[model samples]
Target: MRVSANLGFLYADQPVTGRIASAARDGFDAVEFHWPYDVPPEQLRAALTAGGIQGVSINTRRGNLDAGDFGLAAVPGREDEARAGIAEAVDYAARAGLSAVHVMAGRAEGEAAGRIFVENLRFACEQAERHGITMLIEPLNLRDVPGYFLTGTDHARRIVAAVGHPTLRIMYDVYHMQIMQGDHVRTLQGLGDLVGHIQIASVPDRTEPDRGEVDIRWLLDQIAYSGLVGAEYHPTRAPGDWLRDFRSSS
Candidate 1:
């Protein structure tokens, strides 16, 4: 299982561009971003080329944080903003040579929100397909993100099935899953090809995988995915130190 550093959390002390170089220097061949809109695509591409690392995936812009907007995609009456964010993310991912775009389903509920989410996902899938990029939707845990639209593996699967688009798939974050539900091994194994990307961090504390209550290494051994597993966790020590320890122990 190859691991990619999640620049959003792994190297929080450095600038995004510097995080790419740091990830490369630490032997990571791939990295993922949360919101890199502040960084120009050309600059990001240049940094990735210089570091000889691949930029794997990025999330769509979360709308108006000050206004309590976690995402725009599923919010009623915000279709324009949602689609705009989707277009921007897909375009940016294509320009930066990223393989996928994660569409965030904002804090919403009821049948109306569900319908809006499906429609937005279809739009995102269509745009992503034009650039040969995959579109992903993640289920955020309610504890950390209360009122989040998507919060379970089954819900994500149903949404993907409803869209019926090949480019659209689920971004399974183990940390969130562990919080919202247990039985990670069975859940992931059952999801199979529906899962487009995977992310990991410790449960309850949101720290290094090795420090979590879950036996991450053992859990990883039971899975059969060949794609890059994102190391998306906050580190208490130097990121490299925990990485080395985790790898050596593995």
Candidate 2:
């Protein structure tokens, strides 16, 4: 699989824009980041162009995390706020030439939250499709974010099915899935074409894949043969050294 450097995790020590160049220097195929609104879109676009790398994905703004908001997409009574965020994310991703956008489902819970999640995703997909970009929903494990609305592959699948939009799909994250459920191969096989984007990191401690319980190399090979993959791990050491092992794959 072609690996995209998750700039948000990979180059935490560098300026946001510099992470693009760092990824290029480390021989990454592409790059993805969590939030880019702090920097001008023009600047980010320029960095991507200069680095000669594609920007594969970005996350919608996680409204007021310090106030306990992880995302607004699934929160009831916040449909307008969610839609507005989607609009901004779509506009930025389209203008920046990104391939996908991950719509985070915040701390909302229960039946009402589920309904809101589906509707917001449908609306977001419709909006993103107008710009030829895909919208993704990922299931974050509770260990990392205890109150995250989306937390299992099956739950995410049901939501995607309910939305039934061509542009709306699952952002399958192996790390999260492995935490919530153990059957990776079968789970991935069951999902099939519903997976729009893939992210990976070592479990227990979100670190480089090298020393993890997960056989990341085999997983990478599986993804390479099947679909797209993004390296979204926190480096345990210097970024340069951590990336060296992945350079040859790129």
Best by TM-score: 1
- lDDT tens string, model 1, 36-155? 999998899999999999899999988999988889899999999999999999999999889999999999999999999999999999999999999999999999888899999999
TM-score of 1: 0.98
Off-target runs (Cα >4 Å) in candidate 2 are 223-226, 247-250
Show the colliding residue pairs in model 2.
1-224, 71-106
Error of 1 at 211 (Å): 2.0
Which ranges of candidate 1 are over 4 A from the true structure?
none
Query: Once all C-alphas are superposed, what RMSD does model 2 give against the true structure?
Result: 1.7
How much lDDT does each candidate structure score?
0.91, 0.86
Candidate 2 has its poorest 10 consecutive residues by lDDT at 219-228
